[model samples]
Structure formats: C-alpha cells, structure tokens
Target: MENLTLEMSKNTNTLQEQQLKLIEGNFTKSEALKIINNVVNVKINFHKLQRLSKIEGNVNDKCTYDNSRISELIDDQADMKSFLRSLEVNGKNIKISSTINITVEE
Candidate 1:
C-alpha cells in the first residue's frame, strides 16, 4: 500500500506538470491579434461599402468616382501595415519570455 501510494503521488505530480506545460504552450497572442485585425478590417470594409453604396446608389460608380482617392487608400494600407507590425513585435517579446515546464511519469 505504501509503494502504491508513492507511485500514485508521483503520477499525479507528473500529470499536473504536463497540464501546466500544455496550458503554457497554448498561450499566445500572435494569432489572436491577427484574427482581431482581420475582423476589424472586415467590419470596416463592410461599413465603408454600405456607406458608399448609399451615397452613390451603385458600388461600381463609387469606386470609379473615388479613383482620385487612391493616395488616401494607399496611406490607409500603410498605416494598417504599421499597426500590424507593431502588434507582432510586441507579441513576440511577450511570448519569448514566457516559461513552460513538462514532466512525464515513467
């Protein structure tokens, strides 16, 4: 009974360690920001299209009329890229220092 209890305790500790490692391994901010940015962009694009359609009565017409706004569009794209780059850099710094431990019962 003593040996059995010792073995059970050892297995429990190993299981706890593995669970901790698994949780740590799953902790990430990289993909999360990517998903958030994608969602925000989609929502922005949807609203922009809707507003443009309401203004011009046709989506194609709005695009053609806004042809001179190419510079503004380019600037927006640049800003979005900059924001995403910053997010990625910050996420990398945070993830790198995070520690994880694993143990296995033999």
Candidate 2:
C-alpha cells in the first residue's frame, strides 16, 4: 500500500495540474472598462442564446439558471462600471488579472 501510494504521488496528472492565466494586462480606465465589459457581454450573450435555445426546444423547460446568471452578470457589470467611473484619471492604468482552474468532478 505504501509503494502504491508513492507511485501515485509520483505520477503526473494533467487534469489535476491545470491552471491557466487567461488575462494579465495593464490598461487605461477606458481600455480596462472596454475589455471587461466585452468579456461580460459575451458571457451574457452566451447565456441568452442558451436560454432561447432551451425555450424553443422544450415547452416545459424553463431557463431559470441561465436567467439567474444573466441577471447576476448584468448586476456585476453595473457595479464594475460604477467602480471604473470613480477612476477619473484617463492616464492611470488598471491592472487586470484572471486565472482559470480546471478540476474533474465526481
């Protein structure tokens, strides 16, 4: 059992060792807003399309999850917009960092 555990520990598991730095950049306030807003809008649009597809495909299936997500993203956008607005300096740079971690669920 000890040897088996040691072998397993030595093995390289790609699925468990997955991490990607998706976005890392510094930009002006307007540039940061544009980049962040574009990403959020894409997510919202994706959910909207999914909800529409579900509605058209099934009569009884309601897109509660997608609707909730869309609403949440919209609220996040509003909050971020307000926060970005507070940075009045056009020359000041905002740093954006995003990381993605992938895991397998049982």
**Whole-model Cα lDDT per candidate?**
0.44, 0.72
Question: What is the number of residue pairs that collide in model 1?
Answer: 0
Question: At residue 53, what lDDT does model 2 achieve?
Answer: 75
RMSD of each: 17.7, 10.9
What residue pairs are clashing in model 1?
none
lDDT of 2 at 7: 15
Best by lDDT: 2
Give all TM-scores, in the order shown. Answer: 0.30, 0.72
lDDT of 1 by residue, 34-63 (tens): 443554466567657765766675545535
CA shift of 24, model 2, Å: 0.2
